[model samples]
Target chain A: MKARSFRVLTSLLATLTALGAAAQEEGVLDSAVVRNRLYRPAGHPELSLSVGLPVQTHLTAHYFFDVGLAYNLFDTLAVEARAGYAASRHTGLARSISESFLDRQDKKITDELEDLWQMNFHGVAGVRWAPVYGKLSLVSDIPAHFQAYLWAGGGVGSFKRKSVIQCSHVVDRTAGVCDDRTSLDDRGTAREDFWVHETRVAPVVSGALGFRFFILDKHGVKLEVRDWIFRDSYRVNLLRDDWEAGRETGEKAPSPGLTHLVQFDLGYTFSF
Target chain B: MRTFPRLALLFTALPALALAQVSSGEQPVPAPGPESAIPPEPVSASPQPEPPRAPRERPPPVTPAIQHAPVRAIEASAPAPDAPVAMPTPAPPPASADDTPDLSSEGPRTTDASQQRLVNGAPLYDPNVNVHIVQKKRFADEGHHEVVLYPAVVQLNGKYTNHVGTALHYVYHLQENFGVQLAGQYNWYSDESHFNLELIDKVREQAQAASSLLLQWGVQAGVEVTPLYGKFAFLNNSLAQFSVVLSGGAGLGATRHLIRPAVANEVDGQTFQVPARYGDTGTKFLGSVGGGFRLQFGESYSIRLEVRDLLYTARVDKVDGCSLSDFEAMETARAGNQPFSDLKLSGGCKVEKFDGVDPKTKKNYREDIILGRDLVAEPSSDVLNNVSFYAGFSILF
Candidate 1:
């Protein structure tokens, strides 16, 4: 492990050195390596258009659709907005194990699952900046197909996630689903309907390097993958407390699962 | 093989047998755990050699007499509160029974009518330590510091755990408890299950039972004797607790998938075990703040309620499982190893430790094969944005 780590470190250092050399050849100074890059002054394409799919690591979504545009008036900065749609689902389980009402006393429980699904839509807008370009003079010819841009911008994005969960019982002897709602927190209690949702400003701070695949008819397309740190919250059901109460014999129906959301997000950029 | 059938028969006939045991005049005593419930493997003083440690001969029949005479129980450890139950119920009583045990079977203990009627005689808590199992829900995550606890009011706590699977936890409290909690909490969420699994995607029913247990303990430096309170009106003698848990814990999570290893073909006849990549485990961060209320019950047992918020990092892992979603994308197999078989971790476990890869073949493991999409991968509701209060009885010696 130690040797492998050493090799990886050395290789990374060499990569950094190569990048520095590439920049030096362009006459870009050392201090401005990250900031100085070329960009064309903006003539906001009369109408900016974009369409892309959402990408997430775990949460399932039916599909995600994104549409956005940018109007760059100056070579240094641009304004942009994007709207997205995603599908999400909520799933839960009610666990109960059956034993011989005979000599065996302990029963190992397995969670019985019920799932819920829903969709959400969100949007964002921000001012993008290219600090190095539009300010410095370049003696060498700017590359026609490439521009390394450093953009720092903040925008608001939100999503609405929802779901519905149904409970079923498992008979130990049969080990099959039974009409036994008793496995649920409310078991035989009257069933109820509820809703949970949340909205928060998702951060769009990012840095990118892209090559213009093609620009024509006052239109241009670029492919770039960027990571944007973000935050959001959602709700979940109240089954765990109910299970605990079940173990305790007479414990009351716990407050239905409290609903809260985890906060974080990452974004990729595809320009058109 | 015959024994297994007989065992199955025996299991089916258990309830009837119990009824017979209760009604029979000679009262055959059956030890709950194992035969060792009796005592004196070698008796010291007896002229006629006695059958030592016989279940029927032993005393304290209703409860295991290991410690405080257990209150009567019916199930494994439930309090059978009814008259007949006080004698028949046998749960939660043996939590503290491991003291100087007199495991002698030929003793005075028997299920007498008087013992069953004696309700108020048992101690507040059960004593058979081995018999009692407790699983406490911990909101170990203290939430996001950027939103909640900041510099002035530092929130520090830790947890550690050890279990058959991935139930290990440990934390260090650096200063929250007066510089006591140097804590690190990890909620590892990876890809295993997905909620949006399509119907044609139904998998053979099985248990992908992965569990997590947390432990939090560390140097508690604040006024050791200070009392905290629960916010509820009914709470009494609330304890202001702030401690860091020395963290050392591991998790072994097992998920079983009903596999259908099929081969898919390309434009040409060359086939491969459907090459697919599984997604992430949607684990999240859980944070909580609450205290126990030692309700003025017979014992110092309390009602514990907590207000907590659970946060999940935006998952970068894809949520993929065997589903018709990609059914159209499958190809025919060329035949070497099973396509899904590639997911098997190789190098015997220690060496097969690659994240999301089939360590054995070093191939892209498909989630659909290992963890079907219908499998709930996101933190299950059991550990979701959870918030609940437990009003159970607890005792501190």
Candidate 2:
């Protein structure tokens, strides 16, 4: 074993020595870098569409579909405006909690849960800063060029919240049913629900890190991880009896904190 | 077998060579080296019989600047008069007519040498011998060893639980694009997330014990493959090489559970804040699959960003080495204020762990016996997936 180690060490030293010699023999290293960038998007106008899926679902899930318009002022910078609607739904865990919480009458008073707001329509204007540009050899002959960028923006969005704990008109309390359904076991037939609902317009902020890979002329593909952040507002210290009798009950929480919805976005762009 | 150490040496030394070139920025242009400047030995006067020459390809037509250039001293690295040279495939035209240089034009050299961009001490004005956007790989990883340290591995998809930790990994490259790895990680902070606490607080509902089980530390042996590599420039100033790596492994990991959350305790009319308590829940089989990018700096160092999913089977039937039956006995002993030493219990049960009082907080360990029993009442089981983000740096040698 010692002899093998010695031989290995000797071979490594010899290999490194040969590499140094070869580097010098080549005169100079290949230093001619990105000066000859084959594609630059400066002064170009573009249209793009993107779809975002939730990275992780907890109480809710959101799928966002958006369309965007952008103008590149330089190869490294651009201004873009995006507008979209998000399709949202409650998760299985949330539904399970709602179904069970209705039967637990022992807890006479409790606070409403947080992070129940769902976004519907939204628009934002953002700046994209692409500081990294380079080329990738896909195979022996094909090459792919790409840019890494960061985007940040803020705008107003329409949001709505439906309380799972509050059911003003209970259709069937023993079976834990609050909706207008024809059968007790089948919830699919529900036409309307008695849960308390509220709607508002609030300011939202978004940020992302993404890569844009240019294809043939005038086209590109993008992949990104984006986070939509908004402040959470909910009620606390509610009287269960008051809410069950179709009456307003709780006061707003002093500090409701913030909610973040993280998504993975895939997009396509067409330059005009 | 002989190829193993050669690959190790290749992976180790290649990064160092790349670093040496990057750090040699002081000289924008190296002085003409002695080897390339030496002319070939006189062909007319040879000491031996003439040998059959290998066939070679014709060189491309040179532009005026290259034909009458003053930098003939640096031509040593160029191919001999009758040698084959590989020319990179030229890039396609840009989407719009912007500042992109037209490589197709064979017109007079417009840019002066001084105005030319200097990369790795070579001017970009010379395309045939120097400028290459997607050049051949300058480093090889075969037969090399690398050690990586991740100061922060944060759980990205935490719904019931969250984990933050530091990890260390070692890899031996058996081939240029494939390697074997041994990895170990220790999570300093692992707990049921606030979302889980909110469910318990606002809705009186909580995740089962197994669903919120925490991983303390893990070790695994696996294989890694780098299928693709490329280079890019940062805002036209700096250049770096990167590879896409995917890896998978299976091993063992220590698990635990939060027995109790922090609460205010009253001791002799003085209230003290007691910290949360955790109970050891034994080890479980661990498996992971991950993918990420490794951006090489010079030759020896690199930055890695990856996402990994760690999966483990969690069955909360025991805690602190005490099984359900042993906990039942301990709970009865605690209720009756009887000595636990007389009870018939499993050999692995560590009874002393649940029979003492905390020295500072004046909290009795016996009070937790009931909570531990509640966890294993029905024996909840789950396969927990801990997906996390790993950001770290590595050194190859």
Candidate 3:
């Protein structure tokens, strides 16, 4: 009778073991949406070169040329350092206002315009967090793998301000000319202007939303919309007579606000 | 002591295990291969399987008939039940499943082929066949309606004028890649930007009339086409689908121009702040072209980020139905303390708009006659492009 009980117990144990194996297989059937990533950047170092074009121009426009070095800590995160020089200039609207303001003697007492600061040389270190990875079917046979990422960082930059309202030495008042040109009609002939200029070093913050498209194995193409933000500092409550006569006229504004330089950047990268 | 407790627990669960087996059907489950996990393909019985093609060749378009057909052996890892795996499916060089021939009675597929396979499912005789990557679509968007609400549409290139508003759009999917859309936008806050105001305040200069024209509202009918779609994994945990959408439309928009900025009014020895004034510039023809990404979440919800350029023809010949001649007469009449009621003006002119004095600020509207005249003196015209960023969500039904 004891032998019969042992055989029944053994059969029950074997049945449970089989059921457990089937359950484990069922769990494996629930596969990940994307089973494997095509490109992984972890533990790799990369070098990049980029050019930035102004998205919109108000008083000023900036064209940035930068080179970056980055190290990927993980598949989704990286640290990077970028250094660049921006070739900056005043927009046509700013030039129009500056030339016309030279002749406007009726407006004698007014505050200087805000957001005249322009960035030149800058360097920043930032972390890039790429939380999204995907692939695009470019054509019948080609699949493009890419990552969407956000980057943010802060650094110091050399900035300069050229006053549109204040010309230190006016050449002609009635003709609305502030520079030394051979003829009044052609302002482009002039090499320089007499606009009051100031230069300083200040902190700048930059943020971007971008995509990195992986090519083959080590190469990538990047496109992004980046914004460089900095605090604005300008003089307020100025006298036209004081500035034209080459005399410092106004006091610094208490709260001048912030300036945003938005640009669209296209870049290329190579990984090591 | 631990052994005794474990034995008691196993005995206690024995009845529940037996009940579960009884509830579930008695059919012995197949040893789970990836093919066993797939539900039965709704294809015809005894269908002949196509020979495998090269991996790089374009797959046949997926029509309704082909979509219902059994998943091909090349597309899935499993060989047909009848075709033995040891013998390579003969005919063409080994290729991805995308190279499959169109066997459906209907015509070729218009949309893109299925996504490339990422997971290795079944073992193959040729190791290279294992690299063949293509899988059928898991979701379809044909014949559905989507209503999108853009809570914020902020102007990106606000050089002279600033605009912020909301927009609502309805889209009907005619096909997987094509759709028809009706879009409407209303700008509740439209005004001269601070940059323009600063130029006026300090340099005594401002943007031309046409350059600073503001859009109050617009309505457009357009078509949207999605050229590309893909899947993305977020933080290695969540997955979402996205499509690159491009759209174009032509329509009409209402516009206005700033007549006067806010100023302090002194009436009877007391200073009162008077608000800025805007004059209606009537409706103008508008056109739009835009492109962006639509990130879809599940079946009925999505998030869209787009940049649209709202182009409008701006010709400022009249303001508030008052032409240059009308403004000249109003200014002449105001110079001499004369009532505008007696002046002869166009029948459509709203002379009353410039005749009254504000009761709160005690500011006279007649003082704005010269400013109104200045706007029409040159009759500036421009094709203004107001590029803006739109962030919104959608509900698909």
TM-score per candidate, chains pooled: 0.26, 0.79, 0.77
What i-RMS does each candidate reach, in Å? 41.4, 18.4, 23.7
Off by over 4 Å in 2: A1-31, B1-133
Q: What share of the true interface contacts does each candidate keep?
A: 0.00, 0.21, 0.19
Decide which is better by lDDT, 2 or 3.
2
DockQ of 3: 0.12
What is the overall TM-score of model 1 with all chains considered together? 0.26
Please provide, for model 3 over B1-397, each residue's C-alpha lDDT reduced to its tens digit, 9 standing for 90 to 100. 1133224334433432443343232222122112111222122221122233323343444333222222323343212333221221112221211212322211131231221112233222221232223222233456889999876676656678777778999999888778999999998778887667777777878889999999999999999987776656555434444678899998999999999988999988999999989999999999999998776544576666677999999999999999999999999999998999999998877898888898999999998888888999999999999987666767889
When sorted by DockQ, best at the front, the candidate numbers are 2, 3, 1
What DockQ does every candidate get?
A: 0.01, 0.18, 0.12
* TM-score pick, better of 1 and 2: 2
Q: How far is candidate 1 from the true structure (C-alpha RMSD, Å)?
A: 35.4
Candidate 2, clashing residue pairs?
Answer: A31-B119, B7-B142, B7-B143, B7-B144, B8-B143, B8-B144, B15-B299, B15-B300, B16-B299, B19-B299
TM-score of chain A of 1: 0.44
Q: Candidate 2 lDDT, tens digit per residue, A115-138?
A: 888888999889988767766756
Candidate 2 per-residue C-alpha lDDT over B1-397 given as tens digits, one digit per residue, 9 for 90 to 100: 2233324334434433553454544321211111111122222211111111101111233444433333211222121223212223232223212222333342122243332333333333443432233444445577889999876676666677777788899999998789999999998878787778889888889999999999999999999988777756555534555688999999999999998999899989988898988899999999999998786644676666677899999999898888899999999988899999999999878888789898998989899998888787778899999987676768889
lDDT of candidates 1 onward, in order:
0.26, 0.69, 0.69
lDDT of 1 by residue, A123-154 (tens): 56665553222111111111122232433344
lDDT of 3 at B339: 91
